[model samples]
Target: MPWYAPRHLEEALALLAERPGLIPIAGGTDVMVDGNAGAAGREYLSLAGVANLRGVSETPLGLAIGALTTMTEIGRHPLVCRHLPALAASARVTGAVAIQNRATLGGNIMNASPAADNPPVLLAYGASVVLMSAMGSRHVPYAQFHSGYKETIRRPTEILGEVIVPFPPDHAHHYFRKVGTRRAQAISKVGLAAVLAGRPGSWECVRFGLASVAATPILACALAAAITGSDHSVPRDEELAEALGRDIAARDDIRSTADYRRRVAINLVREALAPWRSQGGFDASH
Candidate 1:
């Protein structure tokens, strides 16, 4: 019922340390939705005024995307677009323009929704999260951040400080697709985000991340191995299907059926890999 608005990051961290149950609100996009539904009864710690947590910066490791950076900023920022185009694409497709203006990278991850658009992209790019507390900060690999559905490794005492996206190889292939009821503002029925290095065959590195098909946005390690090990040839559909079976854990949900999601996920992978199968290699011009 009470609201705590802090103008500084240190002040916010102190408040969180003193009141472990304080719910942090940045964009308030999700929190307001919960409040409107009579579900958000707890006091809110507003981080809107914490200006330090709201921009993008370069770091020795890669790009340091401040936690409070709005989806719209991410989508339009030249740095993000050049280095992590899939992330930029995911941000552009997250919600309508208004929602994108308010929704933030930190809030999205902290919400820990299995169908969230950005997590799969983060996973695919081998990103890391910087979680800060009054004590200090720690980095958690994005792939290991989500432990289960609607849950994350972020501690109650810690605030997500920033997301660190490592630079991919210059010739890397990036792909992202989200299937939902409609294009913008709809929750994803299934989504895939991937970063591939080297050619289709003789692949040097591969990371495929899928959403709405597992307890968490998952790295399809088994599927990646199957494709990467295919001896410079296109993998058969059966092989792809079997690897997908080992990777995803889709189930019947209101938006789609387990069978439908499975089939669609495989098809999406095939479509993304079509460049590999036909072009001899990724064509950057397209």
Candidate 2:
């Protein structure tokens, strides 16, 4: 198979327009895995040489993280840790240190796996993705980007350029956790990334993004609504369980059963909101 490494974004866009089946590969972590499993393309468009697509920068909206920015960079970047702590936490738990060094955020997203780590955080943060083609660029809300399992709205001529993430509101409670066989390297059986805003009993935002329990990573809108609508600081387990039934489409898979995933997901949601239930709200000092 032939590989083309384009040093510029324009050159890469040109190649995509000219070549019919060229797969854009940034970190090549997922691409190499696919190749090893005999499910890769005949040719690949290597974006590793595209220097423009590899850093995090400030934008008017908030932060513009280049598509090729590695997990290692995101995990430790001061801006990410300070502004989007949940994202930084997610990046830290993505695979192992070696994989984190090689896995790009764009690659993690474009791979379209329900078990992917960072996407849930992106969803919880209300992030948007920039897709660029030779024609121009367009921004798609991350929530609407995925069409189905292993599928995305990106056109063949377009490449993911960057991700735009707005800062969360003041005093927001950020929670991120992944339930896997092991702590570090194992794929998530159920992963959650959430941001809770506002005071107890009178909630504002309850954004919860869940993984490995649906066809694609999804925001648990139904469950969030149940929590916000509740009279108590947090909704009861029974109410949460019912709401979760509508939010996730868990299926029995090799890693875990549908019932087990659903149970764990609900438990995680309760555990995340324990502070709100015990105390009036989460303490910002911590």
Candidate 3:
């Protein structure tokens, strides 16, 4: 087995260019499992030494999170908690404290798990990823990243540079819910993240995202459209929830049944939007 650690991202990219099949490991939370199971390959590219890829800062586009930024860092960062509360919430519960301390945000993105917590929040926020290669950098919106199960649009030569989330509007509301099989260390059976803004009398347009409910994490555009401009009454909310459950595709899997998932998802939507309907604001800032 061979290991290479490059201090700079450019240097790492050059190494990757030279050795095309090397597996990149930032936080080994995911890779170590593969290695322990005799699945991780012989060649590994270590990203631990990359200094520039390990911080969170503000940019013109809301927040800029370096590729190697740890989930623990994201969970506690004031800017992240303030502007991206759902993301902060997701980061906090990713894998408990020790895992959060070492697992990187890029690791989650690159891992591309349908049960992952991060992607739904990114989708809800309409975040973009910065991909860099020997050629140049390009920003890809989160929705376009995943092509299939455990697959992404990341080319072999490119590395995720940073995650960019546009600043949320002043009145925006956010909701995130993750339902796992058990109470602890369980994978998500269903998860939902939503961002919406409304006034006292009208239901505003929204963005809804979810994971573990489909082949890939998804932005529930159809569901959002169904609820947009609808009244805040309970009957209408329940009707829309039922309609959304019907429209979404859910399948029975080892962790849970499709019927259970669909039912829970609809209920979760109601629970998440309760505050929005009752108080005319999000509970995050309340």
Candidate 4:
């Protein structure tokens, strides 16, 4: 296999334009696994030496995470843990330390796996993807980035440069949960994330997302509306859970049956939203 390591982002973009079949390799964890299994074809564009594409920084608006930033870095970053703990929590469960050290956020999203831990949390945070191409650059909302299973909106000439996440307001509470076959080193059977904004009692804004239950991570807009507009100060637990269960469109798979995943997804939503109900609403500290 041929590997081209560009020193600059522009050079990388140009290379991608010329060689559309060249897979971009960052930490190489996912690509290496596929290569070892004879699933990846020869030739790749290695982004490791691209000096501009690394690290996490706080921008005026929110946070800018380099596509090359490893899961290990994100999971332990003080700023990320403090501001977006749900994302940090998702990063912590991506894989063991070794895999985490070698897995990049860009690779995770570009891989487009329904079970990728970060997507649900990113969706809940209203994140965006910074895509670069020889033609130019553009930002795509995370929700619109994924087109289908293992597919994304990124053009062949474009490379995912960074992920931008806006800081949540003070009165926002976030939660994430994943159901897998076992407690450790397991891919998710079902994953869920929720963000509630405004006072707990008021709940002016509610966002819910789920993974491993559809073609891609899903935003449960109807469910969020139901919880946010309910006349009851606290959501009706049974009713909300039932609504969540019925909202999912999962198909039977090797890891779990469709019915089982639907049940787990609903239960996870209830679990994630419980804190908001208990606190009498969203807390600023969240």
**TM-score per candidate:** 0.95, 0.95, 0.91, 0.93
Off by over 4 Å in 3: 35-41, 200-205, 229-238, 280-286
Candidate 2 residue lDDT tens string, 1-286: 6789988889999999999578888888888777353354477899999978888988889899999999999999999998899999999999999999989999999999999998999998999999999999999999999999999999999999999999887788899999999998999999999888766565666799999999999999999888878765566789899999999999998999999999999998988787777666654643
2 against 4, candidate with superior lDDT: 2
What is the C-alpha lDDT profile of model 4 across 192-248, one tens digit per residue?
Answer: 988778753466558887889888887777687677667657568776766676556
Residue-level lDDT of model 1, residues 4-81, one tens digit each, is: 999999999999999988889999889888744334567778999986999998889999999999999999999999
**What TM-score number comes out for model 3?**
0.91
Minimal lDDT window, size 10, model 1:
34-43
Relative to the true structure, how large is the alpha-carbon lDDT of every model?
A: 0.90, 0.90, 0.83, 0.84
Off by over 4 Å in 4: 35-41, 245-247, 284-286
**What's the residue-level lDDT of 159 in candidate 3?**
87
**lDDT (0-100) at residue 44 of candidate 4?**
83
Measured with C-alpha atoms, the lDDT of residue 35 in candidate 4 is: 38
Which candidate model has the greater TM-score, 2 or 3? 2
- The total number of steric clashes, by the backbone 3 Å criterion, in model 1 comes to 0
As for candidate 4, its clashing pairs are 200-281, 200-282
The TM-score of predicted model 4 comes to 0.93
